[model samples]
Target chain A: MRLYFEKRKTASKKTLVIVPAVSLVISLILTGFLLLAFGVSPLQTFAAMFRGAFGSSRNFAETLVKAVPLMLTGLGVSIAFRLRFWNIGAEGQLVLGGVAATWTALFASPYIPSFLLLPAVLLSGALAGAAWAGVPALLKTRLQVDETLTTLMLNYVAILIAEGLFYGAWRDPGGMGFPGTARFPQAAWLPRLYGRVHYGLIFALILAVVLWFFIYRTKWGFELHMIGKNRTAAHYLGVNIKRTILISILISGAFSGLAGATEVAGLARRLQEGLIQGYGYTAIIVAWMAQLNPFASLLAAVLMAALLVGGDQVQMMMRLPAAVGLVMQGMILFPLLAGSLFSEYRLRVSQPHKEETS
Target chain B: MILLVQSVIAITIRAGTSLVYATIGEIYTERSGILNLGLEGMMLMGAVTAFAVAFHTGSLVLSLLIAMGMGMVLSAVHAFLCITMRANQVVSGLSITLFGTGMASFLGQRLGPAENNFYLVGLTAARFRRIAVPFLSDIPILGALFYQDILTYGMYILIPLAWFYMFKTKHGLNLRSVGESPQTADAMGISVTKIRYLYTILGGMFVSLGGAHLSLSYTPGWTENITGGRGWIVIALVIFSMWNPARAIYGALLFGGINAIQFRLQIAGAAIPAPVLNMFPYLATIAVLVLVTWWESKGKKRLGAPAALAVSYMREDK
Candidate 1:
């Protein structure tokens, strides 16, 4: 007997949803085994995680707070991925955004009027992210450098640049020599929506709807998808491949930058080493899980945020290390990737000799 | 100043060994049509596993073996995802790194240093000690290179052997063909899937060996993120060397020298801020990548990249 995969003529929508659900269940089972290996009860640990993320209103709010950056970054990554542009440097771009926001809040805000302060800071952050993303995009278009490698290399450079500033000129003088910038003034702080959640939630939600309109509703969005599916085909259809790619990457970087900027303005209120907590990277997974849909990315981001917040609970309550969340997140992607195969193809069993004879 | 130069050179060779191992490993994997971005995670896993095993069993050989085995196992997951399932290689590789790093960190928390500065306990006995070669150790300026650990010496042999195997052997040609044009290789009766899986796993073992070398010889202690972007540097080095194993040695030395100088400057109380000094290697890597990429494009060189690189093969795909 032999088994092989046959391509489906048309994918079933039911399978599309069910496969990922199956993958998630399998991943959870695998993670349960890992928890067992660590001498923890998977059931109680999961319950604790659920409670930590959503049991209380405040906990749910914290989960949303975490989801804010993930959503923004996820949207950013989805934009680039749609163009077949691998922008792995979202982390660095996000950090650079934070740096730009810090510059605005620290220097420009004190000089500008109160009304202009927030917009200037946010705009600077997004522009900074776009600028950082421009390097790899230019290289890809002009020199044919692989953006995956170049973007990743730039991530370290961005982090180092942030570290350099924080440890040097940006170090708070009055705060006992800590390696972080001075706090943002009241005008610069993003107004909280209750608990720790901030206005970034609104920004992310509005952007998601706008992006959904842009990607699925607009002609330019169709061109982006066309290029992603096939560059030659897109060119034949009059899509300016190079210009579209460059613009898409810039927009992608802007979204990631906004994520970083909002993170600092809304939560941290200061640029520091921890400003980038892998939210940008997590956004990659979230974007993939969302199938690059803007609104789906919002849902995916919330789910990922729950995992992250719940991981922390497992660490505190179950005495497991905080790295457990990372492990779970990583494990989830594999099965998800594997399960996606079922969407495009189905398995068939046959006897080789009998087929040939027939 | 001469003594300082000699010591720095010595440290460069020692530090460069792990990078050389990793670069060669990646070269091997990429040559077989897959790019494993999980080098960092795999290395971290190897480092932590070696440290844990050595801490418990106190057997250097066993620890090294287990580390390599662990790396192979991780890469096998990558192979299954990339080859069998036809998953996006970049996402799969990143996922592997994330999973490996997370698992390593989780395990490290359990087996790592009980307190700061106390990580070296029981590790020193299993650590690779420098062995001086007769008459070779007496050579001036280069004498320190002749006296090094077993892993460094093994690398000296492995580099040349890898080059020979990749260039001069029949299997090497088959592997290259698979990477360059998997469909053609498949039509010509070569098993593209088999070659890919074999080389990726083999490449993973070498990468893990480099990680074990870090824990067992160079640093002799496990720390969170012990590889510290070295895996990414190796990725850059593979490009800088234009996928040539022989050329990778120079790339490794250049990076290793920068790392050594950073430490020396800090120790010497250089006036430069420590953070700026620390950025030297990463900045240099970016510079090297850009320069090499530009040079390759300008010269109209073949770029030496396997044509089918990163493309998953399916037998029935049009």
Candidate 2:
């Protein structure tokens, strides 16, 4: 018998949920072995991690703090990914959003009304992120610049701009030379729900539901989906690929930008050095792992955040590197991508040819 | 003025050497239609591994080999995912980078000796130092070229060899055919899958060597920020080179020159901020990318981008 792959007529629905879950289990088992290779007890390590991430309400709330950015950026990346536009600049866009929020809080607040400060900060951040992301989108549509390279390059640029600001003009005079801006006034702060977990979690949940409806139930989503799956078919169906990509990418950047804004306004309460965390990078894993589903992204974000929080706990309690969480996040995709093959194709065992059998 | 020029040129060659190595490797990978974005990750792993191995084994050659082996392992994963599984190449590459980055960082923190307290940072091992070529050392201003580490000297030989292998040989022709039109290449009896897998892994070997050069020659040690986004810059360099290994030299020189200036400005202290200076290479890459894209849009002769760069191939589909 010989084996070959036969394309499925349609994707398997069961694997849609089952594969990721199985892949998560597979990833954990594999990471557990990795811990064993390092002479650590995987079971004990995992137990410590779980307790660190969710041992108490306080711990869970901290996990949510990390999850908020992951959720927003995951949703952000999935929108752009839907159009097959690789927006790796979510990091830069997030930084740009924070920069905009900082500008709004520090410079614009004196002129604007106190009540409007928070809205102004979030909107400005989202707009800044959109504008930063808009460059690659425009270039790709106009001149066919590689979006991946541009987006990646822009990440450094955005990080540098933020660094220059905080390390230079924005350095807090009252805070004894720390590399950060002064704290924002009360009007600009994103309200905390509990234990420093801010209102960003609510925004993320609302956006996920809204985006789910938008992507699954809307005509525009259909256009974007068609363009991603088969652009020739989309074009045959009279879809304006360029316009759809531009609009979706802008909206995508807005989410990452809002992630940055909320991070500053709600979490940090000031623009600081830690604002440029790798949440944007983690967002890619979240988007892909969630299979670009908005609602599922919320769950993936929380799970990934748990890894981060848990990884930190192990570092503190068990003396393991915090990057174990990142390693697991990175490792999950290998099996997931490999597993995707089964969803798209069924393995068939064919009988030997008659002549060969004879 | 002459002294300044000499210093800048020396810095350019030293700095450009690693970029050139990575650019050539990435060029080969892209030429075979496999875009590997995990250069930064691979480089980090290479840097950490090389430094760690050298610190422990005290064998420079062994450390370099191990670093490249690690690179080969990561790229092989990419090849399996993208080729056998027919996964999205971009996401596969991104995942590899993520894995490499985390793995490198993890090892960096864990692979040190007791005295260093289990950290690879701040510990120096055997490193390649500058040696002046006997005859060429006397040349004015240009003599700076003769004074470089062994890695840079190796670069002086490999550049032409790589260019020849790519444009002047039958194997490269097969490689080009595979990238340009895989179906046609298959019709011509070339094994597209083998060629892609071979070149991608081979290219990764060279990329990791570039990373090894950092720990063994450039910075002479491992730091968490050792690569400092050089891996990403190599992607930009590959585009700036328009996928030609020969053309890659120009991109590397420009990048090197930008870095040299950034270094000088940082030392000069106060005309411009350090962060602004640091942004130059990225900003320059953006400018170069835009210019190249705009140039290609003018419908020039050819920019050398492989027609099937990121497209996966299958026999039955054809």
Candidate 3:
């Protein structure tokens, strides 16, 4: 018998939901084996993970804290991915945003009023992210350079630039050679929810709703979707493909920048080493897992955040490396991608015909 | 001054070896229409596995072989997802990278310097040593290139053979045709799937060789992020070289020079911050990417990218 994949006439809605759920289950089973190899009982490990992520109010709050930046970046990535614009430089853009916000907090806050400080920092951060993203967008549209490679390259450059500033110009005088900038003034801090969770959570939720509406309801959203589906067709329909792509990427970059700004203002309180993290890369998986839906990305981000938090728990409890979470995260994508295939195509087994009967 | 120049050139050759292998591998893979961003992860895995094996057994050849095997195995996952399942190449490649890196980090934790000095010492001992050519070592300026490890010398031979194979052979013609227009090639009775799977796996093995070279020769010890951003640099180098293996050698040396200059500057206590100096290679990569793309767009000559570089091909799909 020969096996082949046959494309479906129409996608099954049931399969749309079932595929991811099945994939997640399969991934868990696979990771359970990995945990076994690491000399930990999979059940106990998973139980610990659950407890670590949601055991107490404080644990849940910390999860949300991690989720906040993830939500914003995931939403940002979803928007760009929807338009088929591979803006992999969100990490860099986020760093630039943090730098911009830090600049505003350090130099501009002393002169500005308390109310204006927050807005100025946020705006500057978003603008900085947009500007950094604009480089790749311009290159892609004007010169036809591949945005993926440029964006990826820019991520390294951005991190290095941030490092340069932290080690040179922005190094805190009282830090005694520490590789970080001075802490921001009190005026620049984002208001906290319960003395731990920052206001970034509220912004992320609001942005999710706004982004959903923008993508599903607006005329420009239709154009962006059209462009993603077929650029030549969109161009034929006079959708102003270049303008839409440029704007979508800029908006995407802005959200990621806002994530960076919020990270510093709400949590870090300074431009320090290890400021960027791999949240930008994680958001790529989040966006893909959520199928590029803004609202779904909120849930996906939370789930990913739990995985990370739980990963740390596993490190402490099982004496396993924290990279297990990253491994699990990567494992989830593989199954998810593989499972997605079944949504569009079905496997068929065919028997060979008998030559004598013919 | 001449001594400094000589040392810098020697350092450049040392640093460029891994990149040369990675670029050549990627060029071959891209020529067959598969873009594997998992090179970074593959390199990392290769490095860790090589270091671990060499540390335990003190067999350099065994370590290199095992690393190559691991690379091929990891890339097979990529090939299955992108080619067989028709998943997005970029996402598949990235997933491979993340998975590989995470796995390597988890496995190599115990092999780090702080955790085990004995293993590190073993790795250092098993590392490839440089060999000086008798007459070539006496020559000025050009002498440094001849004084390299066995792998570098092997590369010196491999690069020419690769170029000839790609530009002169019938199989190379088939591979290029498969990448440029798979449907046309398929119509001509070529198995697109076979060619892609073969070249991608082969390319992945070469990438692992690059990684093995890193742990077994260049640094001669296990460290977190030992490859640093060299994998990304290799990707940029592939484009700068216009997907030509011979051209890739020059690009690798140029980037290697940039890397060596930063170290020299730091040693000389230049006024610039070390981080700023570290940014030179990445910045140069970006600049080169833009310049090459812009040059290709402006010139009458088209970029040498395969027409179906990242597209998935299914025989039954029109």
- Fnat per candidate: 0.61, 0.74, 0.70
Residue-level lDDT of model 2, residues A73-92, one tens digit each, is 99999999998899999999
Candidate 2 docking category?
medium
Deviation from native of the Cα of residue B196 in model 1, angstroms:
0.4
lDDT of each: 0.87, 0.90, 0.86
Model 1 Cα displacement at B23 (Å)? 1.4
Error of 2 at A247 (Å): 0.9
Span of 10 residues, lowest total lDDT, candidate 1 chain A: A11-20
Tens digit per residue, CA lDDT, model 3, B1-318: 887888899999899999999999999999999999999899999999998898778899999999999889988888888889988888888888888888787777645455562234333547899999999977887789889999999899989999999989999999999999999999999999999999999999999899989988998887777888787778888877888888989888888887788789889987867676666656776777778777777875756778798899987788
Winner by DockQ:
2
Docking class of 1: medium
C-alpha positional error of residue B4 in candidate 3 after TM-score superposition, expressed in Å:
0.7
lDDT of 1 by residue, B230-266 (tens): 8878887887777878788988987888778877998
TM-score versus the correct structure, for each prediction: 0.95, 0.96, 0.95
Task: Point out where model 1 deviates above 4 Å.
Answer: B111-125, B272-299
- Candidate 3: where is the Cα deviation over 4 Å? A354-358, B110-125, B272-277, B294-299
